[model samples]
Target: MAKVRLSAAAWGLSAVAAGTLVVGCSVSVNTGHAKPKILKDKLGDTVATRLAATTGQPKPDVTCPEDLVGEAGTTTRCTLTTGDGSTLGVTVTVTSVDGDNVNFHIKADETATPAAN
Candidate 1:
């Protein structure tokens, strides 16, 4: 009887540990940090083409790196620039993304200011 109880306790502890591990590693869909493959499949080609054309830069440099952060339902980045005269090096936060369209809010850094009209 004692041995059976001990085995049951061990099984229970193992189950709890497994559950905790699974929960801890679970990914949140809203976290903007979805799997890279998924993001690439969904927005990869389109984003690359658009950014390349808009920035007039080569294909390699226009790629989005992993570890891009998504905050408040948008991805944010700093020091991103296009090859063209128009620069987006300021601290820019994406507010929303719909299909190929992305809405962003830009907070200009002192070093990179907007041109006067």
Candidate 2:
């Protein structure tokens, strides 16, 4: 019957649409496996100073989590607390560093001050 034929065609079209969606949504895995450098706050004074300058805030007294080290050239999560009792949590990618000055890209949650309104 025509109704049976139409139903089969609709099922076939649905299957094709599902296949197309799955193929279109497929993503290739990244091949790069470079490991990122793990820097701890207790390692040395350089890391402490660098973290302080990078965040423009004082270093935190708490221990830094090991999982903060992300893949190289990728965003790494970091937390810094200033002496004034303010806390900053950020995701940053380090570009370069020289002495106490560090250059980096911040991903989000960069807070400075409340805007005057």
Candidate 3:
């Protein structure tokens, strides 16, 4: 996991960009077949990449508990851990699906949670 330091205001601004960030993931899906999903690592990497681009910061550490289901309205929670050990909650929601492409929205929490002692 990579960690990047960020000011509170920078986090806030990133949060705003997060709200409107839509990432499209390409994966093959067959109707009436097994369910499709974005793997945990892939999801985390995508989020980190987008966040880094938005904030002009190094790619931060992000972890997802489970794979994100590739279905409209499906969602999963991922965490972004900063260099100082603070964390921000990120919600990834599937907004729409088209053929083999999955489009989702990423929204970060308005504030960070201080590290636990």
Per-model TM-score versus the true fold = 0.26, 0.33, 0.77
Q: Give the per-residue lDDT digits (tens) of candidate 3, residues 50-83.
A: 7777666777788999987778999999998876
In terms of lDDT, the best-performing candidate is: 3
Candidate 3 clash pair list: none
- Which residue runs does candidate 2 get wrong by more than 4 Å? 1-36, 42-47, 51-63, 67-70, 94-109, 112-117
Deviation in angstroms for 113 in model 3?
A: 0.3
For all candidates, what are the clash counts?
0, 0, 0
Candidates in order: C-alpha RMSD to true structure: 23.5, 23.0, 4.1
RMSD of model 3, in Å? 4.1
* Per-model CA lDDT versus the true structure: 0.33, 0.36, 0.73
* Top candidate, metric TM-score: 3
Instruction: Select the stronger candidate by lDDT from 2 and 3.
Output: 3
Residues 1-117 of candidate 2 have per-residue lDDT tens digits of 221112223323332333333222211222223543434443223333443344343432323454323333544555433334443343445454333333344332335222234
Q: Itemize residue pairs with steric clashes in candidate 1.
A: none
